[model samples]
Target: MNVKQEHLKETNPEHEILDILKNRWSPRAFSDKKITEKEVKILLEAGRWAPSAFNVQPWRIIWGIKGTETYDRLYNCLDEFNQSWADNAQVLMAGAFKKTKEGDKENFHALHDLGLFMANVYTQAHSMGIATHQMAGIDFKKAQKEFKIPEDFHVATGIALGYYGGDASVLPEDLQEKENKQKRERKPQSEFAFNGNFQNKN
Candidate 1:
Protein backbone atom coordinates (compact mmCIF):
# COMPACT_ATOMS: atom_id res chain seq x y z
CA MET A 1 0.00 0.00 0.00
CA ASN A 2 1.26 3.48 -0.88
CA VAL A 3 1.62 5.60 2.25
CA LYS A 4 0.74 9.09 1.13
CA GLN A 5 2.32 11.81 3.21
CA GLU A 6 0.47 14.62 4.87
CA HIS A 7 2.00 17.92 5.90
CA LEU A 8 2.71 17.91 9.63
CA LYS A 9 3.44 20.80 11.97
CA GLU A 10 3.39 20.25 15.71
CA THR A 11 5.08 22.52 18.21
CA ASN A 12 4.69 23.27 21.91
CA PRO A 13 6.58 26.13 23.55
CA GLU A 14 6.62 26.65 27.30
CA HIS A 15 7.11 30.39 26.92
CA GLU A 16 6.57 33.07 24.31
CA ILE A 17 9.20 33.02 21.57
CA LEU A 18 9.64 33.46 17.85
CA ASP A 19 7.21 31.29 15.95
CA ILE A 20 10.13 29.96 13.92
CA LEU A 21 12.00 28.81 17.01
CA LYS A 22 8.85 27.29 18.44
CA ASN A 23 8.17 25.43 15.21
CA ARG A 24 11.72 24.13 14.72
CA TRP A 25 11.79 20.56 16.03
CA SER A 26 13.59 17.83 14.09
CA PRO A 27 11.41 15.26 12.38
CA ARG A 28 12.44 11.79 11.28
CA ALA A 29 9.75 11.48 8.62
CA PHE A 30 10.53 13.82 5.74
CA SER A 31 8.47 14.27 2.61
CA ASP A 32 10.29 13.32 -0.59
CA LYS A 33 9.79 16.81 -1.95
CA LYS A 34 12.67 18.46 -3.76
CA ILE A 35 14.33 21.55 -2.34
CA THR A 36 15.41 24.23 -4.83
CA GLU A 37 19.00 25.37 -5.26
CA LYS A 38 18.14 28.93 -4.29
CA GLU A 39 16.71 27.76 -1.00
CA VAL A 40 19.87 25.78 -0.34
CA LYS A 41 21.97 28.89 -0.96
CA ILE A 42 19.88 30.90 1.46
CA LEU A 43 20.51 28.39 4.21
CA LEU A 44 24.26 28.45 3.58
CA GLU A 45 24.32 32.24 3.38
CA ALA A 46 22.70 32.40 6.78
CA GLY A 47 25.40 30.18 8.21
CA ARG A 48 28.11 32.33 6.63
CA TRP A 49 26.88 35.31 8.61
CA ALA A 50 27.05 33.59 11.98
CA PRO A 51 29.56 35.24 14.36
CA SER A 52 32.82 33.44 15.01
CA ALA A 53 35.77 34.07 17.24
CA PHE A 54 37.89 36.84 15.72
CA ASN A 55 35.63 36.55 12.69
CA VAL A 56 37.45 33.40 11.60
CA GLN A 57 34.15 31.75 10.68
CA PRO A 58 35.49 28.28 11.34
CA TRP A 59 32.52 26.30 10.12
CA ARG A 60 32.73 24.65 6.72
CA ILE A 61 29.60 23.17 5.15
CA ILE A 62 29.43 20.61 2.38
CA TRP A 63 25.98 19.86 1.00
CA GLY A 64 24.08 18.08 -1.73
CA ILE A 65 20.46 17.46 -2.66
CA LYS A 66 19.03 14.05 -3.45
CA GLY A 67 19.73 12.56 -6.92
CA THR A 68 23.26 13.94 -6.94
CA GLU A 69 26.55 12.14 -6.45
CA THR A 70 27.42 14.48 -3.62
CA TYR A 71 24.30 13.38 -1.85
CA ASP A 72 25.38 9.77 -2.15
CA ARG A 73 28.72 10.59 -0.57
CA LEU A 74 27.08 12.51 2.25
CA TYR A 75 24.48 9.82 2.85
CA ASN A 76 27.05 7.04 2.80
CA CYS A 77 28.88 8.70 5.67
CA LEU A 78 25.92 8.29 8.02
CA ASP A 79 25.78 5.45 10.50
CA GLU A 80 23.41 2.58 9.73
CA PHE A 81 20.78 3.92 12.15
CA ASN A 82 20.65 7.40 10.62
CA GLN A 83 20.76 5.94 7.10
CA SER A 84 17.51 4.17 7.91
CA TRP A 85 15.52 7.44 7.71
CA ALA A 86 17.93 10.06 6.38
CA ASP A 87 17.62 8.71 2.87
CA ASN A 88 14.16 10.27 2.64
CA ALA A 89 15.50 13.76 3.22
CA GLN A 90 15.79 16.16 0.27
CA VAL A 91 19.22 17.47 1.19
CA LEU A 92 22.23 16.18 3.12
CA MET A 93 25.10 18.20 4.54
CA ALA A 94 28.19 17.76 6.66
CA GLY A 95 29.39 20.43 9.05
CA ALA A 96 33.06 20.76 9.90
CA PHE A 97 35.26 23.19 11.79
CA LYS A 98 38.70 24.37 10.76
CA LYS A 99 41.02 24.05 13.70
CA THR A 100 43.21 26.83 12.39
CA LYS A 101 42.71 29.75 10.03
CA GLU A 102 45.41 31.10 7.71
CA GLY A 103 48.65 31.43 9.69
CA ASP A 104 46.63 31.38 12.91
CA LYS A 105 47.01 29.12 15.92
CA GLU A 106 44.41 26.51 16.83
CA ASN A 107 41.10 28.15 17.64
CA PHE A 108 39.92 26.90 21.02
CA HIS A 109 36.35 28.07 20.34
CA ALA A 110 36.03 26.45 16.90
CA LEU A 111 33.48 23.90 18.01
CA HIS A 112 31.38 26.49 19.82
CA ASP A 113 31.40 28.68 16.71
CA LEU A 114 30.22 25.76 14.59
CA GLY A 115 27.23 25.31 16.90
CA LEU A 116 26.23 28.94 16.33
CA PHE A 117 26.60 28.46 12.58
CA MET A 118 24.24 25.48 12.65
CA ALA A 119 21.76 27.41 14.78
CA ASN A 120 21.72 30.07 12.10
CA VAL A 121 21.10 27.45 9.43
CA TYR A 122 18.25 25.99 11.47
CA THR A 123 16.57 29.36 11.98
CA GLN A 124 16.95 30.29 8.34
CA ALA A 125 15.50 26.98 7.24
CA HIS A 126 12.51 27.23 9.60
CA SER A 127 11.78 30.74 8.30
CA MET A 128 11.61 29.37 4.76
CA GLY A 129 9.05 26.69 5.68
CA ILE A 130 11.72 23.97 5.65
CA ALA A 131 12.26 21.42 8.41
CA THR A 132 15.76 20.15 9.21
CA HIS A 133 17.26 17.46 11.42
CA GLN A 134 20.87 17.58 12.64
CA MET A 135 22.50 14.36 13.75
CA ALA A 136 25.74 13.42 15.47
CA GLY A 137 25.23 9.81 14.38
CA ILE A 138 27.71 9.65 11.54
CA ASP A 139 30.82 7.74 10.57
CA PHE A 140 33.17 10.66 11.12
CA LYS A 141 36.16 8.86 9.64
CA LYS A 142 34.23 7.94 6.54
CA ALA A 143 33.03 11.52 6.13
CA GLN A 144 36.60 12.77 6.22
CA LYS A 145 37.96 10.20 3.79
CA GLU A 146 35.00 10.34 1.41
CA PHE A 147 34.95 14.11 1.25
CA LYS A 148 38.75 14.56 1.27
CA ILE A 149 38.42 16.77 4.33
CA PRO A 150 41.75 18.18 5.47
CA GLU A 151 43.54 17.09 8.63
CA ASP A 152 43.02 20.58 10.06
CA PHE A 153 39.26 20.15 9.96
CA HIS A 154 37.00 18.19 12.25
CA VAL A 155 33.66 16.92 10.92
CA ALA A 156 31.03 17.66 13.53
CA THR A 157 27.56 16.63 12.41
CA GLY A 158 25.13 15.74 9.65
CA ILE A 159 22.09 17.79 8.60
CA ALA A 160 19.03 16.53 6.77
CA LEU A 161 16.55 18.95 5.24
CA GLY A 162 13.07 18.55 3.82
CA TYR A 163 9.39 19.07 4.50
CA TYR A 164 7.89 17.12 7.41
CA GLY A 165 5.87 14.04 6.44
CA GLY A 166 2.77 13.02 8.33
CA ASP A 167 2.52 9.34 7.46
CA ALA A 168 4.36 7.98 10.43
CA SER A 169 3.26 4.47 9.44
CA VAL A 170 6.14 4.42 6.99
CA LEU A 171 8.56 4.23 9.91
CA PRO A 172 9.19 1.27 12.17
CA GLU A 173 6.25 0.50 14.50
CA ASP A 174 8.09 1.78 17.57
CA LEU A 175 9.12 5.07 15.97
CA GLN A 176 5.78 5.59 14.23
CA GLU A 177 4.08 5.68 17.63
CA LYS A 178 6.15 8.66 18.69
CA GLU A 179 6.39 10.41 15.31
CA ASN A 180 3.98 13.24 15.90
CA LYS A 181 2.71 12.26 19.33
CA GLN A 182 5.80 13.05 21.36
CA LYS A 183 6.11 16.33 23.26
CA ARG A 184 9.14 18.62 23.01
CA GLU A 185 11.10 18.44 26.24
CA ARG A 186 13.78 20.61 27.84
CA LYS A 187 15.09 21.34 31.29
CA PRO A 188 13.83 24.45 33.08
CA GLN A 189 16.02 27.57 33.18
CA SER A 190 16.40 27.25 36.94
CA GLU A 191 18.40 24.13 36.49
CA PHE A 192 21.00 25.73 34.22
CA ALA A 193 20.84 29.45 35.02
CA PHE A 194 22.39 31.02 38.11
CA ASN A 195 21.97 34.28 40.07
CA GLY A 196 25.65 35.23 40.26
CA ASN A 197 27.70 32.35 41.57
CA PHE A 198 27.05 28.60 41.55
CA GLN A 199 24.47 27.31 43.99
CA ASN A 200 23.31 23.78 44.69
CA LYS A 201 20.06 23.90 42.77
CA ASN A 202 19.95 20.14 42.67
Candidate 2:
Protein backbone atom coordinates (compact mmCIF):
# COMPACT_ATOMS: atom_id res chain seq x y z
CA MET A 1 0.00 0.00 0.00
CA ASN A 2 1.21 3.49 -0.77
CA VAL A 3 1.20 5.33 2.55
CA LYS A 4 0.78 9.07 2.40
CA GLN A 5 3.10 10.96 4.75
CA GLU A 6 2.20 14.47 3.70
CA HIS A 7 -0.85 14.19 5.94
CA LEU A 8 1.46 13.29 8.80
CA LYS A 9 3.24 16.64 8.59
CA GLU A 10 2.79 19.16 11.36
CA THR A 11 0.16 21.79 10.68
CA ASN A 12 1.34 25.32 9.85
CA PRO A 13 4.44 26.23 11.83
CA GLU A 14 4.86 29.63 13.39
CA HIS A 15 7.61 30.21 10.85
CA GLU A 16 9.08 28.49 7.80
CA ILE A 17 11.48 25.55 8.18
CA LEU A 18 13.54 23.19 6.08
CA ASP A 19 11.78 20.26 4.40
CA ILE A 20 14.03 17.85 6.23
CA LEU A 21 12.81 19.16 9.58
CA LYS A 22 9.23 19.32 8.41
CA ASN A 23 9.27 15.79 7.03
CA ARG A 24 10.96 14.11 9.96
CA TRP A 25 8.52 12.07 12.03
CA SER A 26 8.77 8.58 13.50
CA PRO A 27 6.35 5.81 12.59
CA ARG A 28 5.96 2.33 14.08
CA ALA A 29 5.72 0.51 10.76
CA PHE A 30 8.71 0.13 8.43
CA SER A 31 9.36 -1.40 5.03
CA ASP A 32 11.53 -4.49 4.70
CA LYS A 33 13.89 -2.83 2.23
CA LYS A 34 17.48 -2.97 3.35
CA ILE A 35 19.52 0.18 3.82
CA THR A 36 22.86 -0.03 1.99
CA GLU A 37 26.13 -0.10 3.90
CA LYS A 38 27.10 3.23 2.37
CA GLU A 39 23.85 4.78 3.51
CA VAL A 40 24.45 3.42 7.00
CA LYS A 41 27.83 5.10 7.01
CA ILE A 42 26.26 8.38 6.01
CA LEU A 43 23.96 8.19 9.01
CA LEU A 44 26.84 7.40 11.34
CA GLU A 45 29.08 10.07 9.87
CA ALA A 46 26.42 12.68 10.45
CA GLY A 47 26.14 11.63 14.08
CA ARG A 48 29.92 11.46 14.51
CA TRP A 49 30.36 15.08 13.53
CA ALA A 50 27.83 16.42 16.01
CA PRO A 51 29.24 18.92 18.53
CA SER A 52 30.18 17.82 22.03
CA ALA A 53 31.50 19.54 25.10
CA PHE A 54 35.25 20.14 24.69
CA ASN A 55 34.98 18.01 21.54
CA VAL A 56 34.65 14.76 23.50
CA GLN A 57 32.65 13.16 20.67
CA PRO A 58 31.04 10.90 23.21
CA TRP A 59 28.26 9.29 21.16
CA ARG A 60 28.56 5.64 20.13
CA ILE A 61 26.20 3.61 17.96
CA ILE A 62 26.15 -0.14 17.52
CA TRP A 63 23.95 -1.07 14.58
CA GLY A 64 23.01 -4.00 12.38
CA ILE A 65 20.91 -4.34 9.27
CA LYS A 66 18.03 -6.80 9.01
CA GLY A 67 18.67 -10.56 8.52
CA THR A 68 22.12 -10.26 10.10
CA GLU A 69 23.29 -11.77 13.36
CA THR A 70 24.05 -8.32 14.70
CA TYR A 71 20.52 -7.24 13.95
CA ASP A 72 19.10 -10.20 15.82
CA ARG A 73 21.24 -9.43 18.83
CA LEU A 74 20.21 -5.77 18.81
CA TYR A 75 16.53 -6.61 18.43
CA ASN A 76 16.61 -9.00 21.34
CA CYS A 77 17.70 -6.13 23.53
CA LEU A 78 14.53 -4.22 22.97
CA ASP A 79 11.64 -4.44 25.39
CA GLU A 80 8.72 -6.64 24.37
CA PHE A 81 6.54 -3.69 23.48
CA ASN A 82 9.12 -2.25 21.11
CA GLN A 83 10.01 -5.62 19.61
CA SER A 84 6.42 -6.12 18.50
CA TRP A 85 6.66 -3.16 16.10
CA ALA A 86 10.38 -2.70 15.57
CA ASP A 87 10.73 -6.18 14.15
CA ASN A 88 9.81 -4.75 10.77
CA ALA A 89 12.59 -2.19 10.76
CA GLN A 90 15.52 -2.96 8.48
CA VAL A 91 18.12 -1.63 10.88
CA LEU A 92 18.40 -1.55 14.64
CA MET A 93 20.88 0.41 16.75
CA ALA A 94 22.07 0.65 20.29
CA GLY A 95 23.02 4.18 21.22
CA ALA A 96 25.49 4.89 23.98
CA PHE A 97 27.78 7.56 25.38
CA LYS A 98 31.30 7.23 26.67
CA LYS A 99 30.90 8.90 30.03
CA THR A 100 34.49 10.07 30.23
CA LYS A 101 36.63 9.65 27.16
CA GLU A 102 38.87 12.57 28.03
CA GLY A 103 39.69 11.70 31.63
CA ASP A 104 38.37 10.05 34.76
CA LYS A 105 36.22 13.07 35.48
CA GLU A 106 32.56 12.60 34.58
CA ASN A 107 31.21 14.29 31.47
CA PHE A 108 27.97 15.74 32.66
CA HIS A 109 26.87 16.74 29.20
CA ALA A 110 27.29 13.35 27.52
CA LEU A 111 23.57 12.56 27.39
CA HIS A 112 22.78 15.98 25.95
CA ASP A 113 25.53 15.49 23.36
CA LEU A 114 23.96 12.18 22.33
CA GLY A 115 20.72 14.02 21.61
CA LEU A 116 22.57 16.30 19.18
CA PHE A 117 24.15 13.30 17.51
CA MET A 118 20.75 11.62 17.14
CA ALA A 119 19.23 14.77 15.65
CA ASN A 120 21.92 14.78 13.00
CA VAL A 121 21.30 11.11 12.26
CA TYR A 122 17.57 11.78 11.92
CA THR A 123 18.11 14.65 9.52
CA GLN A 124 20.65 12.82 7.39
CA ALA A 125 18.51 9.72 7.16
CA HIS A 126 15.41 11.74 6.24
CA SER A 127 17.37 13.38 3.45
CA MET A 128 18.02 9.89 2.06
CA GLY A 129 14.33 8.87 2.26
CA ILE A 130 15.00 6.73 5.31
CA ALA A 131 12.97 6.97 8.49
CA THR A 132 14.36 6.46 11.99
CA HIS A 133 12.42 5.93 15.19
CA GLN A 134 14.40 6.37 18.38
CA MET A 135 13.16 4.42 21.41
CA ALA A 136 13.70 4.91 25.10
CA GLY A 137 12.00 1.60 25.77
CA ILE A 138 15.02 -0.71 25.71
CA ASP A 139 16.67 -3.29 27.85
CA PHE A 140 19.66 -1.08 28.62
CA LYS A 141 21.54 -3.54 30.78
CA LYS A 142 20.95 -6.31 28.26
CA ALA A 143 22.22 -4.13 25.45
CA GLN A 144 25.29 -3.14 27.40
CA LYS A 145 26.27 -6.72 28.01
CA GLU A 146 25.27 -8.06 24.62
CA PHE A 147 27.15 -5.30 22.82
CA LYS A 148 30.12 -5.59 25.19
CA ILE A 149 29.88 -1.93 25.98
CA PRO A 150 32.62 -0.89 28.35
CA GLU A 151 32.02 0.38 31.87
CA ASP A 152 32.97 3.89 30.80
CA PHE A 153 30.05 3.99 28.41
CA HIS A 154 26.34 4.04 29.25
CA VAL A 155 23.59 2.74 27.00
CA ALA A 156 21.01 5.45 26.37
CA THR A 157 18.61 4.60 23.58
CA GLY A 158 17.72 2.37 20.65
CA ILE A 159 16.75 3.20 17.07
CA ALA A 160 14.80 1.44 14.32
CA LEU A 161 15.36 2.54 10.74
CA GLY A 162 13.92 1.61 7.41
CA TYR A 163 11.82 2.81 4.50
CA TYR A 164 8.27 3.56 5.60
CA GLY A 165 5.77 0.69 5.70
CA GLY A 166 2.49 -0.48 7.25
CA ASP A 167 -1.10 0.55 6.85
CA ALA A 168 -3.47 1.10 9.73
CA SER A 169 -4.60 -2.49 9.34
CA VAL A 170 -1.09 -3.67 10.09
CA LEU A 171 -1.40 -2.61 13.68
CA PRO A 172 -3.69 -3.85 16.44
CA GLU A 173 -7.06 -2.10 16.44
CA ASP A 174 -6.06 0.00 19.44
CA LEU A 175 -2.90 1.15 17.74
CA GLN A 176 -4.36 1.14 14.24
CA GLU A 177 -6.63 4.05 15.02
CA LYS A 178 -3.73 5.98 16.49
CA GLU A 179 -1.45 5.02 13.61
CA ASN A 180 -3.98 6.20 11.06
CA LYS A 181 -5.05 9.43 12.70
CA GLN A 182 -2.67 10.83 15.29
CA LYS A 183 -1.27 14.30 14.72
CA ARG A 184 2.15 15.43 15.86
CA GLU A 185 1.83 17.60 18.95
CA ARG A 186 4.39 19.75 20.68
CA LYS A 187 4.43 22.54 23.24
CA PRO A 188 4.67 26.01 21.82
CA GLN A 189 8.08 27.71 21.77
CA SER A 190 6.80 30.13 24.36
CA GLU A 191 6.34 27.26 26.81
CA PHE A 192 9.94 26.09 26.70
CA ALA A 193 12.09 28.77 25.03
CA PHE A 194 12.51 31.40 27.67
CA ASN A 195 13.67 34.95 27.08
CA GLY A 196 14.82 36.20 30.48
CA ASN A 197 12.67 35.27 33.45
CA PHE A 198 11.95 31.71 32.23
CA GLN A 199 8.22 32.01 32.75
CA ASN A 200 5.45 30.91 30.41
CA LYS A 201 4.60 33.66 27.97
CA ASN A 202 0.96 34.51 27.33
Top candidate by TM-score = 2
- CA lDDT, every model vs. true structure: 0.83, 0.82
lDDT by residue for model 2 (114-176), tens: 999999999888877788899999888999899888888999999999876545465556666
lDDT, model 1, position 41: 96
In model 1, which regions exceed 4 Å deviation?
Answer: 1-14, 102-104, 199-202
Q: For residues 77-191, write the lDDT of model 1, one tens digit per residue.
A: 9998888888888999999999987686878999999999999998888777678899999888899999999989999999999875535666667677667675667778888
In the predicted model 2, the residue pairs found to clash are none
Number of clashes recorded per candidate: 0, 0
Worst 10 residues of 2 by lDDT: 1-10
Q: Report how far residue 159 has shifted in candidate 1, in Å.
A: 0.6
